[model samples]
Target: MEKASSVLAALFGSREPAEAAATVTSIFVYPIKSCRGISVPQACVTSTGLDLERLQWDRQWLVVNSKGRAYTQRVEPKLALVDIELPMDAFKDNWEPTDLSYMVIKAPDMEALRIPLNKKCAAVDDISVWEWSGSALNEGNEAFEWFTKYLGKPSRLVRFNTELEIRAVDPNYAQGYKTLFTDGFPFLLASQGSLDGLNELLDEPLPINRFRPNILVDGCDPFSEDLWKELKINKLNFHGVKLCARCKVMCLFVDDTGWPWSVLSACKEMSGREVKGCCCREPLRLLAWAMEMASNAAADHGCRQPVSLVLRILPLLGTVPCQCTAPASASAAACAPLSCFIPTINQENGVTGNEPTSTLMKFRSDHALKLKKTQGKMFFGQNLVCKESLLPPRGSKTIAVGDPVFVLQKYSSNVDAPI
Candidate 1:
């Protein structure tokens, strides 16, 4: 406790009392939905989301089916294998892409496809993502044929028509806040401390990519973003409106081959390459195993308290397991230290579950008193809506790595409150 206090004092020596003293550690922008992300040193904070204008904006493009429905990693795990890139200079402000400038896309067993950055096409109507159904700019027949061939299905690449459509965030959360093609809010912010905390419980630690956060921060305690109702970064205000609910996409195996586990066997059969190390895709059972592992960890930690209790206790201890000495009474046997046992679960190839998501549910579930009204769901990061969008003279706001983060306001009760 003394060591942590000294560290905090040193860290916050230059910050105001209201600030949490965190800093931006990383920023990522997904050019295409359910595809690989590009890490940038800085990104323009737009009303819709992160943008580089003529280069790439987060989720500005979507891959749709013949029915005009969006295809994501959920339904098509192979989309994880799709790699997209643009010129590094494109991320610079006011950088323009010439006629020859293109966004190159590559996939396993497919030729590289390059689409002009400024390419325009006739409006394709009835394209849908979640509840929003509207017209979008088609990426031409060549782009369509490429996706169809790569995905082994009828697919079309369509760009969002920002001028014609206004997709509003749910009024119940943050009124008038709009997003491009994100699941809900414009920005998702996560804490590195939270990831490290969860990683301690997993047999194999998962990367931040699994959560797909737009902004990643460090130097704060685990899950501190949950209590942050309002914050400022790079002179722009960001309001934490809701907790980010996770889905099955995080459980899918993303290998170096960029291919999902489901296609490895087929790739082996066709290409006759050695496919010995990859784990089989078990989306359903993996989630179950992750939950079971977390439950077991909690049980073996010498305490069987509810998740909310543990969360409430985390801030004081700077750790998960209780730090009390071993109990002497028979009735208090459950109060033992977590170090008493080592988890024997093998994670190399025999492991059946995904980490972080499975463990996040054990502590960040909606069953807590402060979150009970929400639907039963597992949460990780905080969904943010920039206040600049709601203010006058809205202009491009830039956030870069190492920018100081200040918490201006917070919820009265932590999400860790007991139910």
Candidate 2:
């Protein structure tokens, strides 16, 4: 096995040993399987994993049978192609700081459904949703009707309840806590260099979306993220729990419409794994295992283990191959063009990209913002107290209240005001 330090040095260009510490640049969670992700600036680290306003796994909204057993996209490859939208309305009055509102799923046909915020409903017929524990869920009939109508197949919706007490086997040999329905672990990490490397290996470059990772880190060599056991980026810290095992999903091709299986044969040939799996399968597991061993090595070396990596936050520049640090003028220049690229509601000048209704509710409450609909326009307010005209849909438009929205342009407003 390669020495972890040597591997790190090879992955990222030469850096001072002290300067090469691991850090988390971004955190993402998908509340529903094969749907969009909710990206947050910061999250609380827990024993179970990241706590994003009580939402985890990202695939908690599942299709199950009358017996309450769960189903995955693996058996129904079409499930991987669905899209979901969580509108802003679901997060209205009942919003809590910790509550996740709605979830949305998009079908292969591109039709979208916004599930209600409520968890209880009727059960679907003949379809049971099963968790990792092999226990069946009672996803109500209403969910089945909704899914069957949209999916054009017999399916039902199920939610991973905190009450179910599902757990995964921790590598440390401790009992794990209940999870919302992730693939099989607490965290997924991906390296920008690794993706870039793979793109170089392929005839054409693929988007990072194909990997569906929970974390994206820059400044590391290709595949170096697999060697980290604990990493701290700015103020965020990550304790990598286990290796994320890969499956054939990585080789599944998603066309412009996001449908898979078009290039499975090609991927098999490319990976030389006709019966083994896709590229993401063994590679992901190998990376995870390497990180765990690295952490153990660091501990054995008698080095002080730091809690969470500390990172100095930087503004996002909306360009391919984005640099972590950039000038204010550059940042503003990058953001200025976003308004014309996105559709917006004229009232509050808010721009939305197909968010699920329930998750939107949690977003509003956590940020203390109110999203109101007026004459087909969506207006936003700060705690229903101070309402401001919606700004143009610049790249900054995606920044929510609780998020650390950096101002790239200088303004003469109250310098002492809280962000």
Candidate 3:
């Protein structure tokens, strides 16, 4: 196993640095937790790793369960359907974080959830996000009830509390750095060249949104980011921290109302009943076959024959254990790979169950490129931390789309990291 921090040393390999400077192609920010991100023409850069009061514009808000545990698309796949819209037009005056008052959040069948942003607002401390826990402004029961209704669970909204807390970056990677609700670092960066290279190998090409990088630069060879040690986008200086390890969250079926996870759940329920028929009949073989159909319906978008459900009802049936085998690497282990949708059974109960089944819906581009080239870890982007002084003191400084990007470091191989 790899360290909790920079696990790329065993996997990501070396590449030649591009002589040509890169261009800023796109910048995206996700104001709401696990929802769709909006591309910005320009974003105000802020210091994250330091003990700054608060960092804004990134993952400032988060969704917490009853226990205050963070919820992401990994568990709530429909989070992808929640639309997070920024108040760009409100920036007519000063472009500082204070200028923004609220963000509009909308989901399917529900009225928009509006939450105000108060930089000086007090917060509820000890909100858990993996190993590091910190303070966050509890967005109140109205926000909680709205999320609980949509997610079908006791979920609430919390914003990062800059007034009372600062999260440090992993010491293994960098020191004195802090990011909000992000998995690790403050910024995630990728290049157009890498995407083009990946698209060449995939049967279904993915948009840049699928990877969810903070900065998308043009030019450079495929996977050039793997070798970047230091960089400067316009005036902001950054240290390349680590190669990101991607999970199934990157490959989700984004829909108008989150991905139709609920719809698939309904499909499984409806199909399960059709197998049991009107006579309380259960053909042992038909029951087993029907479960397969449900799993398929949950994984694939294509509709299947309802005949599997309506199979001729037979009175003869026996309850049998349904076993789902783990991949060779995780044999007998609990979790499955990103590409798999396996159900686990408890020996004591003979009942089988699983979390919502997920498949590689987007980024069908070659995993061989992302998964193999960077190590079996599948690094899709670069995590960056910037110097505190580099950020604008007040308001916003517009960085045009075609700004020049300079690699501040000289050519060298990484000692702690892999090829």
Top candidate on lDDT is: 1
Model 1: per-residue Cα lDDT over 14-129, one tens digit each:
23445556999999888888787788998877543322121138888899988787776544556767788888776665567798898899887899989888776788998877
Over 4 Å off in model 2, which ranges? 1-26, 34-57, 65-69, 87-101, 108-111, 118-131, 134-139, 170-178, 233-237, 247-419
List model 2 lDDT by residue over 150-179, tens digit each.
645566666555443444434242233334
Clashes of 1: 1
Greater-TM-score candidate between 1 and 2: 1
* Cα error, candidate 1, residue 284 (Å): 16
> How close is every model to the real structure, measured as TM-score?
0.69, 0.46, 0.63
Count of backbone clashes for each model? Answer: 1, 46, 9
Question: What TM-score does model 2 achieve against the real structure?
Answer: 0.46
TM-score winner between candidates 1 and 3: 1
Q: Tens digit of lDDT per residue, candidate 3, span 312-363?
A: 1111112322233222211111211221211111112222223111222234
**Model 1 segments more than 4 A misplaced:** 1-20, 47-56, 247-353, 368-370, 415-419
For residue 302, give model 2's deviation from the true position in Å. Answer: 51
